[model samples]
Target: MDINAYSARLHRDLYAAGQLGGEDALVLAEKMANALDPSIRLVLLDAMVEAAGEITEGLAPGAVEVRLAGREVQFAVTPPAVAEPIQPGTAAPAVQPPAATGSEESEADGGTARLSLRLPERLKGRVEEAAGAAGLSVNAWLVRSIAQVLEAPTVQPPPAAPSTPSPTVKIVTGQHITGWVR
Candidate 1:
């Protein structure tokens, strides 16, 4: 089987599945052809071999070995040394801060950040309903709500006193008041 032909067919199939345009598919196919990474090629070959095995199962079963034209190379990789376990009563070493990178700075400067939070199902449903009612996306609604809460004043002035001076007045704690009467 011609590898180029197989690759081209794979590209078309992938483009169709992905719903990509003709020009995009052509570009992607060209990239794939140029790359020709061994792992990806092996994966395609493996799938084909598996399918062939299924087809030939009635004729011969048990095990199948695939032979490919390639030179074998071997290299020894030293395993990383394991750290000694901490003895009982010994304090663990402090963790050092990670070195700052360009990507981290870029992420901080208006770049999109992903936030994943686990909320109760009931709360999530309520938030989604509120968001729909407000004609805003859930993300937008949450952002606006958070901003409002942060911008609101923590304390408010006492409310204005009535014209008739009562001997004693109940001091409301939680309510937002305006003025303090002397």
Candidate 2:
């Protein structure tokens, strides 16, 4: 197995996801060089799977497409879904969602949901920048941020109300020879 090739692909995946950058690629390389903990290694493996989702996010949303190394590929991101409306007098038979393909299922087997978001090139670059500043892998950073958001409630502006003046308490302390209050 080509370790460099593996790293390169991981770099591309993270780069596309607005997570990792050129610099992060080097840090990950260094980590791989030293003895890595099994748990941490598992996390890196998940990050790689998540990176694949990131690459998909960068693709155009029409029919599936592939690009050659020396060619430019054009595409869009519209995922097709069957959402037939229920008839007025009759009910439609319940249908189950199809099982995920082997490759897609493999990611879930590894414990990461592998979600993705399509972002413009400039925006993706900014994500990489932010990830670099935080010294985290692109997938790691994005996943952490997403988990935090999911765990926290959305912020709402405070409601406006009738103006009620707050009560003020007065404090009197006299250690010196001077004490005055108005």
- Candidate 2 vs. true structure, TM-score: 0.28
Q: Whole-model Cα lDDT per candidate?
A: 0.53, 0.49
Please provide TM-scores, in order, for all candidate models, with all chains considered together: 0.28, 0.28
| Number of backbone clashes in candidate 2 | 7
- Clashing pairs for model 2 are 19-138, 20-138, 60-75, 60-76, 61-76, 61-77, 61-78
Total residue pair clashes for candidate 1: 4
Candidate 1 residue-wise lDDT, 1-182, digit = tens:
44556666766666565455577766776666557646557776667655643432322212222345452222212222235789999998776543232223334665534466889999999997996665444544565576566658887769986686555556668885445455
What lDDT, from 0 to 1, does candidate 2 have?
Answer: 0.49
Query: Which ranges of candidate 2 are over 4 A from the true structure?
Result: 1-110, 157-182
Q: Show the lowest summed lDDT stretch of 10 residues, model 1.
A: 72-81
Question: How well is each residue in 1-182 modelled by candidate 2, as lDDT tens digits?
Answer: 12344545655554454433466765665555443434444555555445545554443121222222332222322342446788899988788753223234335567445355898999899997885565444554565566566659888869987466445544557644332333
